[model samples]
Target: MALRPAPVGTGIVFTRIDQGNALLPAAYDLVSETRLGTTLRNGDGVGLAAVEHLMAALWGCEIDNLFVDIDGPEVPAMDGSAAPFVFLMECAGVVEQGASRQAVRVCRSVEVIDGDKRIALTPADDFSVDLLIDFDNPMIARQSSCFHGGSFAFKTEISRARTFGFENEVAALHAAGFALGGSLENAVVVGEDRVLNEGGLRYDNEFVRHKTLDCVGDLYLAGAPLLAHVDAHCSGHGLNNAVLRALFASDRNWKLEPVMSALPSWSETAVAAEA
Candidate 1:
């Protein structure tokens, strides 16, 4: 992973250097689909996958401007979590730019549901997330957690939460010619009341926490920091992308503002200003 300083107002863009110099703007219009993970496609056939977690880390850290150049179809699934990506960014050191930071303010509640899964964005002075997950497995019956955005605390609390899967599903994934790089080192595996992997879960509720991590990343596609309270239940990458698309589809639901150096506190101002 590499961090390159971006031009003012560039936002976070992913350029597929492998695909004939195509640029995919990290926005809702570029979202091609949500299959196993979030995917973005440019008109020139360049695309990126599994970008939500990295996006979340950048957004959560309040990095408003960046240019990401990747030479592959999918980003390196380093340890299958966001912690490594966070570490890389920390090592690179985030620098403050002369440009102002912009944010998307949610003015109303917007929600999307597919079957029993649902995700919602509500008005808030600051960005926050509440995530809930339910699995049939006994180890991960139901889990939930909340995060106040812009807090790097999430790096420790949730970033290391690993992607999980069942043993039966692994065979299917291989047959489909995916996860060639996946292994026990990168993913958590469970089988019928027992943890198949030698190492157990990093956290008791890692499943839900990973979902929260994904929410943070996918929501960043708004192309700006957002001030809203997000609540989600048993949602995946597809649903999260849908929620973003819904918010942007209606201009009445939200507004984008350029970053400002001076802003009133949430309690002091009737409406929070961009920063």
Candidate 2:
């Protein structure tokens, strides 16, 4: 993957080089489904999988314009989290153009609920997140956390947090032909009594941290950076995508901001590039 500069107002677009560099807009209208993970499909049959981690990294870093090129069906699950993506962006470098940044400022509260899961977006001065997770397994009982704007706290604390699954689910996953690339190195696995992966648990509360990480990524589908306080509980890609769809379904829910009076301050290295 490469983080190439994009024209202002282009938002974030993913290009599949294997398919003639076809472009897929990263928007709610293009979201096809959230089976094992979020998938975006374009009219031209171009699609990409597991985009939430990368999206979260970009949003957390306050990158308003970018072009991502990939040559596979799935973004490389590099180290099973967003840390590698962050490192790659750091290496490729970020550039600021003459144009300012635009964001989708939430004007009202929007929410979606399914059984015990819920996701809500509320008006806020800047992007923020509060998340909680509860699982029956002892290894991951309950965990929670919150993040304020431009914290990028998620990068060091949660970005490398791997996706997890149960041992019992593996048989069914393989039967369904999923998790073909999953392993202890790429994911955290839990048994009924303990974590199956060696050297278990990067953080005792890693479960919730990963969930918070996913929210940051999924909410980026709003088509721009957002100024909303999001709260979620035990929500996955499906619920996150549903909340975005609901937000887009009604004009009363949200509106686009075309002008940006300020751009986020780039790092010293990135600032030099802009100069």
Candidate 3:
């Protein structure tokens, strides 16, 4: 797959070369499914699955327009993190377009809840995330992350975090043809008493950090980058998409704003890539 430059207002589009070159938009309204990951389907039913990691990387890098040429059904689950996708964007290098980037400035707080899980977005002068997770397993008891910086912080503190699953769940996932490409090499598998990975962890609480990374990708489905503080607990892809729908339904909930200076690191990195 390759990322090609697109004109302003193009948003993110995925073209399937094998599927008669069908195009699908990476927008919330185009989201046809959100099982374990986000799937975008066009009216003709041409689909792309598990795009969150790539989308998250694009959001972190402040990339607003692009054409993704893919020969397969889904983006490769490279190492189960956004870091690889970040690397792809950096190598391609980003250039400023004639128009300023747009962001959805939250005006009213929006919340979505499903039993014990919940997610909310509140108006803020800057973007941030507050995430919390708790599991029944002793190995991954409770973890929380609060991130307050932009691109650089995401790469250093959140990007390297890999997706994780339980040993008991892996067989079931593969049986269902869900994680056929998943392995200990791409995901951190946890046993009852310890992690199965040889390297232990990239961070002490990598599980929650990966969840925060997913949240970043999920929220970008709003069709533009967000300029609000987010708070989430025990929420996954389902609840994330629900919250975005609710936020977009209410007109007073958000407004568009010109890009600010918070994303200088991505711009600077792009320059370094071309040197």
Clashes of 1: 2
Candidate 2, residues 1-275: lDDT per residue as tens digits? 66677776677888998899989877867888787777889998789988888887776666767778889897777766777777777666666656556667788899999999999999986778889888888788888888764735766786878778888897678889977755677778788898888898888887887888888888888888777899999889999999888888888888777544444443211211221
Global lDDT for candidate 1?
Answer: 0.77
Task: Extract clashing residue pairs from model 1.
Answer: 56-217, 101-259
Best by TM-score: 3
TM-score per candidate, in order? 0.90, 0.89, 0.92
lDDT of 1 by residue, 26-124 (tens): 886778878777888888767898888788777645666677778889877788788887777776666665555677999889999989899999998
Q: Each candidate: what lDDT?
A: 0.77, 0.77, 0.85
| Candidate 1, run of 10 with poorest lDDT | 266-275
Of 1 and 3, the candidate ranking higher by lDDT: 3
Candidate 2: global Cα-lDDT?
0.77
Task: Point out where model 2 deviates above 4 Å.
Answer: 175-182, 258-263, 266-275
